[model samples]
Target: MPYVNIKVTDESVNAEQKRQLIEGATHLLVTVLNKDPATTHVVIDLVPTDNWGVSGKSVTRLRQQQVKEAIQAQAERRAQEQ
Candidate 1:
């Protein structure tokens, strides 16, 4: 089982966003996390932006640098804020 608590912005969350996170996390459990889809469990929880950081920078201090670029891109395209 894999439990993933994703800290994201309240300004950047939605139902489809939640679904995408869950799906993506589940995929990770099966792929990167090395869990078998048939026997694994996955859970997702959304936290406020205050709880997330990127490359040593807190969400509030976001600088839009390369390190946060992919993650930010994912959020924009997937409706998520991870």
Candidate 2:
């Protein structure tokens, strides 16, 4: 069995979101990784926003904005490294 863990801010996910996440993530693994969805275990969590900080400030204040900036920065950094 394969297990996947997802971490995200609490405001972005709820019980219904968790269900969708598990199903969708499982689908991705099945299609891309050639893993059996039936045997894959997916765990979704709502991490405290404080755990993710951005731009000299706490993510607790600007969750969505910080997440967007973080993603963009990550992509930029990867592009630079490549």
Candidate 3:
């Protein structure tokens, strides 16, 4: 039996997307390793942004920084247009 674990941030992932991910993972194992779908196990884990970090910063912080930068850029653009 082949076991696959997928981890993603606790973002807006709908049920259909989860279903597709499971299906795609199963298909990949079947095609690449010739694993039996019936015996293949796929698990998805969602981690909170605060628990997930990159480059010494949490995902929540990174996302906040991104939004701040976007807003600043937009303001600059408006100032230039005026």
My TM-score estimates for the predictions, one after another, are 0.46, 0.64, 0.96
Q: Rank the candidates by lDDT, best first.
A: 3, 2, 1
Stretches of model 1 off by over 4 angstroms after superposition = 38-44, 48-82
Clashing pairs in 1: none
lDDT of each structure?
Answer: 0.69, 0.83, 0.97
Judge candidate 2 at residue 44 and give its lDDT.
76
lDDT of 3 by residue, 5-58 (tens): 999999998899999999999999999999999999999999999999999999
Which is the leading candidate under lDDT?
3
Error of 1 at 12 (Å): 3.5
Candidate 2, poorest ten consecutive residues by summed lDDT: 8-17
- What clash count goes with each model? 0, 0, 0
Candidate 3: which stretches are off by over 4 Å?
none
Q: What is the per-residue lDDT of model 2 for residues 1-82, given as tens digits with 9 covering 90 to 100?
A: 6799998776757678788989999998988889987899998777787877667766786866768899999999999999
Superposed Cα RMSD, model 3? 0.6
Q: What is the lDDT of residue 80 in candidate 2?
A: 100
C-alpha lDDT of residue 48 in model 3:
95
Q: Per-residue lDDT of 1-82 in model 1, one digit per residue for the tens?
A: 6666675565567789788877887888888868877665555556555677767776665744555887878779887544
